[model samples]
Target: EDLIAIINQYGGAIPETYGVPVEEIQKGIKSGVRKVNIDTDNRLAITAAIREAAVKDPKNFDPRHFLKPSIKYMKQVCLDRYQQFGTAGQASTIKQIPLDEFAAKYASGELTAVAKKAVTA
Candidate 1:
């Protein structure tokens, strides 16, 4: 609760330099904290999966043997984070712009034309 207290006291004005526990991640999110790093947890999950896969088949020389489990574990972590952040079903909320059109506009300078015109005027 100490971490939550500090965050609440500062109103999340300060960026947390240390890793926040998973149990407290939701608290941070609810408190209006914009970004949270869960790299450590994901790394731990990947490392553990790799170790287990390697040990289970000591004679296996193919990289795919270990990578398969690693991918599964990493994917699970990513999905969990997406759900926790309330972005699991938010794809429709994003503007559906085509990549090629965006690239064309960028290349033609149309994307920033208004800003350029404003600056010159």
Candidate 2:
């Protein structure tokens, strides 16, 4: 649907008016959702950037010309998403458990209950 701004494909294109609201996604993140899939948003940003670059210099046949801005726009979207989800800089807080240590913990039956609880919750 997003690509409708440029081209209409086989299934026909609709307006780019459908999406999960950012506030709703943020609410889910706050309510203990461990992960959020936001691939479409990122793709839209990248596509927009590419389209802008292509339109600005229609004869620019080099792929790099399109890719540079695409990377920048996608990076900004990722950063904004991270901030919105309150996950920015949270990677440093993650404790790295080694594979052997994790295996031992699981073998000792320590992780099974936690895994089951997570699944059922």
Candidate 3:
């Protein structure tokens, strides 16, 4: 496949490889590619949504009328990507402490040392 050939040639340093189909995205993920950017597809979806919304409601001059559909379309695309990445049901597995508790610990200087090491590393 073209994707495999490119990965073989460039290893992990390829730049700006966008417009990959959904099946190729899975293949890339399986091939140890950690980051996948989908900004272009999301942008296209949002643009189409806004244009459709504007045409459907020609009387509405409010930006929210267009933005609502755009946001909805973008969110759906993101949710689809999450599912494709096999990470959709991971919310319950993430250990997230309360923001107030985290802030208290941070203010008490508990995370200062950890923060410095993290930043330096």
Model 3, position 106: C-alpha lDDT score: 94
State the lDDT of candidate 1 residue by residue for 19-108, as single tens digits.
656668877666665577767656655665666667668899899997898788778887888898766888888887799988998999
| Preferred candidate (TM-score higher): 1 or 2 | 2
The 0-to-1 C-alpha lDDT of every candidate, in the order given, reads 0.66, 0.75, 0.70
Task: Please give the ranking of all candidate structures by lDDT, highest first, separated by commas.
Answer: 2, 3, 1
lDDT tens digits, residue span 19-100, model 2:
7888998776666667798788777767777777777789999999999988987788889889888889989899999999
User: How far is 21's C-alpha from truth in model 3 (Å)?
Assistant: 1.3
Model 3 Cα RMSD, 1 decimal: 10.8
The better-scoring model by TM-score among 2 and 3 is: 2
Q: What are the runs in model 1 whose C-alpha is more than 4 Å off?
A: 1-19, 96-121
Question: In every candidate, how many clashes are there?
Answer: 0, 0, 0
**CA RMSD per model (angstroms):** 11.6, 5.3, 10.8
Model 3 misplaced regions, further than 4 Å: 1-18, 95-121
Whole-structure CA lDDT of model 2: 0.75
lDDT of 2 at 96: 100
Please give the ranking of all candidate structures by TM-score, highest first, separated by commas: 2, 3, 1
In candidate 3, position 59 carries an lDDT of 91
Best by lDDT: 2
